[model samples]
Target: MAVSPELEGLRRIVPSRFVSFSFPNPFLGGAPNPYGDSYAGECIRVAVLDSPLPAPSVPSTVAMLVPAGRHRDWIFSTRAGHLHLLLSSTHVSRFIILGPELSAPSPRVVSCVSRPEPDPAHARLLPLLLALCPAAAFLGNARHAVPDVPLLTFHDDLLRLAPVKVVAGPVVGEMVVEDVAIDCAPGPVELRRRLRFKRMPCLVQTQVRLCPSSAAAAAASSSLLEALDGSGGLLQPEVGGSLVEPYLQAMVAGLAVIAPSVDESIQSGVRPTCLCAGVGGGSLPMSIRVGLQFNVLGVEADSVVLDVARNHFGLVEDEFLRVHVGDAIQTIEEFSRQGEADMNFSAVMVDLDSSDAMCGVSAPPLEMTHANILLSAHTILHHHGVLILNVMPPPADVSFYQGLVDVLRQVFSELYEIDVGNGENYVLIATVSPIETRVTDNSGQFLTELRKLAGDFLEHIRKI
Candidate 1:
């Protein structure tokens, strides 16, 4: 990772400024930058964005935000030289700065540069960089502990002379040590640990083209729509471990049964809608994958959870996807009474318990019974609509599922159900229209588009 001529040019123009480190990506096992050196209040703080962000104690500027999903993060500049961090969600995180403000002719500026990475040329880099931070905070520190005090002392001396701009892999925040590369520097750099240098995929710099608000909005919308089409409806399929395969397969089953008509309607300028109860970072990712033209309405009962979805999980509710914080059941009833026909959805989905499992914590139950809620969610759907619910059914009590099927059958015209691949959960897809396996051609391939959308879960599905 040699220093690019572009970055070198940036280094030449910018005045020397100090930065403090804040917030650690827990998975990374330690804090990134060490700002232990004496610095004034004017210094900026670099932080790795995560849920439950750490308190910075001082104002901070976002170098980059690398959370999952389709959220884009970049540094935006104005003509007056004032810079802003334009998050992919289009929401701005404010931080006061002593740095220069924008002053150019343009209202904003987009600078495209390669994202930083680790420079392998540095010797004992990982271990050396690892030693920069103390080990008291991490659990596994004692077993892999090295004499970091001496190395810190050494780096302290090196910094006393001149600040070295070092290239570190994304693992170390593309760190710029003052003058010497770690490998060349003198320190007890022993990497007794088995960890090897790992780079995070093929790094591509986020492109920011600063223009009018309209152009920016257009770009973001196109990007989100393109994300589903490009992925073929599969984004990070490994997220939920064993349950993911079946869960997605179930989504496909629902989408499969409705895609033909929904796809046609949208192409003809009739944008179909889907209401997802319980919004997570991956909620929009999942539904949009199933249907590109879908405009999603995400309903979450918890306002805090909705904020987490917006701030942490990158749940941006654009024109295509909208999130509302309210009871799914009550909200649907309200829409029905108001005769908001255009706001009605063709698909209604529920995964209310996703957060309970995701956070490994439980909360009190909602006032409505599960059956009651599902019945209410079904009321606002169009005649050709479908309901996909992710549920936890008792394995021992076969009667539990039987009871649920009975509840849905009372309202829905027909039902198709599949167990998650891991078999921990059941996805019940109930529809108002009938669906059947279509005849194959002479080559024996299936004739219908539904089977293709159903993917591997075709056989797992049962009609009732």
Candidate 2:
């Protein structure tokens, strides 16, 4: 199969590093053609100018320029006129290209266009062109007519179009902390803080590594500590800061629905207070304190974990936000003994997780769910307060979940569960008093109310 003179001439001036053409197989005499008989045997080729590679005998269905490295400059240079002339003379019907680099997880389509109709040779390619880029439109016969909306809108940031080179900086700090009460293995554990990022140079993530070498640590878990913005400040709560985890968002949603008294307390010029257990990275408590304007008391069993939260995750302690480094269970009991007038809380949030994989439950440990602890947690709440728990049951562990729910029913008059839909975690909202509002009966109405109360916080919750 020799190359056609016309295609060879077009290929010579296209500035492509790789190009390949595909023609219908002649052996399949009666096979159906997706693009109809008019283009059944017509040859099609795709060219990408970025990387150097050998052309394939049979190429993929569609290949569009990704426009990275030097190719981006070429696409935007004065030579674009020559590229437009080449496109008009060739059989290619569409071109999909990305705009300047963005903070998004993946490149977003900026421009996609096809040639106008009445040209049968290009019609077969139209269906695929439209499918790949639903925003595709005809730009007369000139490829240069394609709009550059994304580029123009972000013109000021175009300087950032240069590729970011991410190099993991040296460990900023490290420490060893141990607490037997929590689920981690019984040994000295080391935590190291380092910087990591995807593409955006301004958006850097501070991650904490906990005992990466220990077998027990591997069996237990690890997590991202926090994300920071360009100004050396934590990113907005919605970006990667605050309660972006689905289960945490569900817990916030539960809090919004069951604790209406928080609003009243705020209106009366008194800040509502919440007690949060399991202060991993302190995002949960900080979100409630800053976003909802509540006075938050965070309790973590290990002081080292609290230190990591403060030193690495941007957790700050103020008059309104305080942290207690000790056993959360004991703290709850002490609060219960203090009498409601002196130490009543608007909400009690338990977000602890078990270190033992065989424990059958993933979160808030079995002890946090003990009948005594539940009673104590119920005792310290304001008369209208709510208790929110993040519980993760082993897959299809029906007996464990049902037993936990049964125990919860014994402690609270009303129990509601929000399925985070992640298959593992569920946020349980328990109230000492019954919910009287008819809106709770309707699931849609309940979500609507939650949305209203949560506002921007709801953006992180998935599946409503």
Maximum-lDDT candidate = 2
lDDT of 2 by residue, 1-464 (tens): 22345343322212232333343332135543322332323333233221112223211122332222212232322123123322322233223332222221222211111111223323433443333321222223145433221111111111112121222312222222111111123543323232222111111123332223344434344431211111122122121233435577778777655444555676678988889986766777777776777799998776756666675555789999999987888899988887657478888999876544222235667788789999999999888888888887643244767778889999987887787776677888888787665323224432444454444444343211
Steric collisions counted per model: 22, 1
Task: Give lDDT tens digits, candidate 1, residues 1-464.
Answer: 22223322321112122222432212122333221121112222232221112222221222222111101111211111112121111222222111111221211111111112222212323332232222332233455443221111101111111111223332112321111111214653110000111111111111011111344444543442222222221222221111122464465555556655575676688777777765543433333534354677777665654544443333566677777878766776677667666856788776544222112111112322256665666667877788887665532234656777787788777887777665455777888677543312112222143344355665566666
TM-score of each: 0.42, 0.47
Q: What C-alpha lDDT, on a 0 to 100 scale, does residue 235 get in candidate 1?
A: 23
Q: What lDDT does candidate 1 reach at residue 75?
A: 21
Distance from true location, Cα of 151 in model 2, Å: 44
TM-score of 2: 0.47
Q: List lDDT for all candidates, in order.
A: 0.39, 0.49
Kindly state the number of residue pairs that clash in model 2: 1
